[model samples]
Target: MDLDAEFKLDDDLCYLNHAAVAPWPLRSMQAVERFARENAMRGAAHYPRWMEVENTLRENLARLINAPSPRDIALVKSTSEALSFVAYGLHWEPGDEIVISDQEFPSNRIVWESLADQGVTVRVVSLDGDDCEDDLIDAFNNNTRLLAISSVQYGTGLRMNLDKLGAACKAAKVLFCVDAIQSLGALPLDVEKSQIDFTMADGHKWLLGPEGLGVFYVRPALRESLKLHEFGWHMIANRGDYRQTTWQVAPDATRFECGSPNTMGAHAFQASTELLLEIGIDKVEALVLNRVELLERELNKIQGIEILSSRDRQRQSGILTFRVAHQDSQALYRDLMSRNVICASRGGGARFSPHCYTPDAVIHTAVERLAECIS
Candidate 1:
């Protein structure tokens, strides 16, 4: 695939915010367009084909995360919904505890914390220590029922040692869950290697797809342990057999999908997922980190710009956050937006997250635009 041709962004725009919402590649956009046209003219005549696309997406997602099978993947509305599945479905004891990092996105934190009514404790461990992974591992005791953390922190872009954490969780017999939105498309993730019991990520971010669609993975052995709170025709083993008098809940992860599928979102997300898989995650991670490195180098050259993200190679991600001496982060963000430097105001600074396809010239231009924002 011609990488440059896939992303035909505007000449004046420097898109450096893939960590938030990524613009879809041409193929993905075209897939949506084709779906729209087919819906208009052909109607449900192409329904079976659409189902195939959705199933393919599940397989692709399984491949992306190295899940045991596509049966482990559930198409979800968003990461929040998947998190809710675990939050409400589980039978929690009054004194049970869930371990999480302090820097989790609200989707990960708020859901777990909301379980306080059930007398569950949300243990927020500080990742500020020299060895953040160890800090998390140490937080786990007999009371800890689960450990939920992001594969990469949203603001500071600190990549966690998931394998080490996973191993610890397995040994401690705690459920390992990861909010993988920030790292899924840009970095390679293996649920098996990491011993993750549950994981979810939206397609809009690094996946280069639209909103309203995401992937949820639940370990097969623990599937029934999470009692389902949502029920509908689609989640049944006899799905589509509207005339049947008896029904059984799906035997696989599809049991979590309680309603009609997002067919349009599925088409586009599958296209985007296939594109990333074609490029290969290891190659994508390398290219993404290279862009971040360039951003760090260029941003450092400007006067009074202080890099806030980690410099450790293991901890580094596509995100590079920085702030100016006298400027407020939001003010700098607005200024950059006015200058057509597409970035985000986060981590108490301006965050620039470029994908694998981001050009070096765009990275340099974004840094130059930031200089203007401060100057």
Candidate 2:
């Protein structure tokens, strides 16, 4: 398949910020168009087909994360909403503490920190200098009720050893939660082997869908532990039985989904995920890593650039960040953007995150353009 055709980006611009918001595949665009057209022509006449699309999305997400069943998936509005579901859903006491990395995106940190008013404590673990993987495991204690971390650090693109962390969480009896926004589509994830208690990701980044929709995965055993914070008709077990005065929460992960689904997001994400499945996660991972390696080598050769991303293959992903020796990172970010080299300023430098579909010429051009701009 021609991946370039899949994205159909403008010929004049090169998008290297998949770590931020990504452009949806052409297939996704077509899907959304069809969905909109159907809605205009025949409203609820095709609701059954829409539900089927939603089911397809759940199945695709389950396969992506290696969840045993589609019933474990809960479609939510955003990563923040999903994190909130877990943070507020649980009952916490004065001394209960949650463990998290210092490098976490605010979505992961803010939710847990908000619990401070409830007499819960949030411990921020620094993952910068020391061996971060081991330190994360060591941070856990008897007071630790849960450990929330990003699968990949947003700014530095540090890929954590989820297997090791999962094992530690299992042995320590602490709940394991992963903020998978950065790594979901770029890397292969297995919730079962990783022993993750909860996981969530917005489709706008690596999944190449829109901003509003995200997926939340909760382990089967821990589902009942979280007290429901949001409630609506859709969350009821007998969703269609409106006449029945008495109601019970849905038994599966759907309980987290309180109201009407974002059918638009569902249509778009379903299309995006189908392309990822066709390309295969392993292949995508390999392609992305290769591009990142090329970027690193090119950036290293530049006179003023300093590569900020980890050199360790096991601890790296698609993000390649670098700072100019004498120029301010923000200044360089502005210069690059002004010149049409689309990127972001992150981890104290400008971050360029390309996907498997990014053309090699675009990578070479970006590096060359930076050299010229900096010089």
Candidate 3:
């Protein structure tokens, strides 16, 4: 398939900031437009069709993460909401510990830290060592109740060995939670194979969808263990029965979703995920890695450019962050943005994250623009 035709990026712009928010594919844009038109004309006349799209989105997310069942997936507003569900749902004892990497995004870090009032200690392990996984595993002890980590560090784009951490968590009888925003669509993620107890990711990044929509996966057995923090008619087992007086919380992951769904966002994200599935995630991953490799190779050739992201092939991700030796990162980021080479300042440098559909010309132009800025 000609993937380039699927993306409708402008000719003068070079968008390489997929790690942040990504431009939607043509199909996704069309889907949103259709949804809007339907709402404008027919109102809720086609509501059943909208529900079907939502179900399809759940299935798509289940397939993307290799989730055990669609019942395990919950459509959430953002990764932060999903993390909040896991954080506030759990009953924390005083002195209980939650292990996390020092490199986590504020969403992952702040949630666990917020439990401090309950005397829960948040152990922040550094990922700077050669044996990073081992360091994280060593931080867990008998008092450790959970290990919360980002599948890929947002700043440095360092991909963690989830399988290794999951195995250790299993052996230690500790719960494992993964913030998968960075790698969800760009790479393969299997909850069962990795032995992850919980995982969440927003669709805006590598998934190539809109913001305000994400998926939360909770393992089947542990669903009941998490106390419900939110309650509503939608989360009840008798969801559509308005007259029913007594109700029970949903047995599945839907229990986490207490209110109305983001139907519009669901339609757009579903279309985006369908496009990814049609292209095949394995193929998408390969193409994305190729683009990142190209950026790394060309960026390394420029004098005084320092690649802050890991060069170790196993740890590399779609994000390639680097800084010029004598240049200010923020100033350089502004220069790049001014030149229409869309990117972000992160990890103490400028971060370029290209998607599979990004054209070769855009990559070359971005690199050339960077070289010019530095020169």
lDDT of 1 by residue, 1-375 (tens): 689999999999999999899999999989999999999999999899999999999999999999999999999999999999998888999999999998888899999999999999999999999999999999988899999999999998999999999999999999999999999999999999989999999999999998999999999999999989899999999798999999999999999999999999999999999999999999999999998888888888998988889999999998888888887899899999999999899888989899999999998888887777777
Across 144-229, the per-residue lDDT of candidate 3 in tens digits comes to 99999999999989999999999999999999999999999999999999999999999999999999999999999999988988
Q: Please report, in order, the local distance difference test score of every candidate based on alpha carbons.
A: 0.93, 0.92, 0.94
Quick one: RMSD of model 2?
Answer: 0.9
Query: TM-score of model 2 relative to the true fold?
Result: 0.98
Model 1: colliding residue pairs: none
lDDT of 2 at 179: 96
Question: How far out, in Å, is residue 335 in model 3?
Answer: 0.5
Worst 10 residues of 2 by lDDT: 7-16
- Backbone clashes for every candidate come to 0, 0, 0
What's the lDDT for residue 32 in model 1? Answer: 92
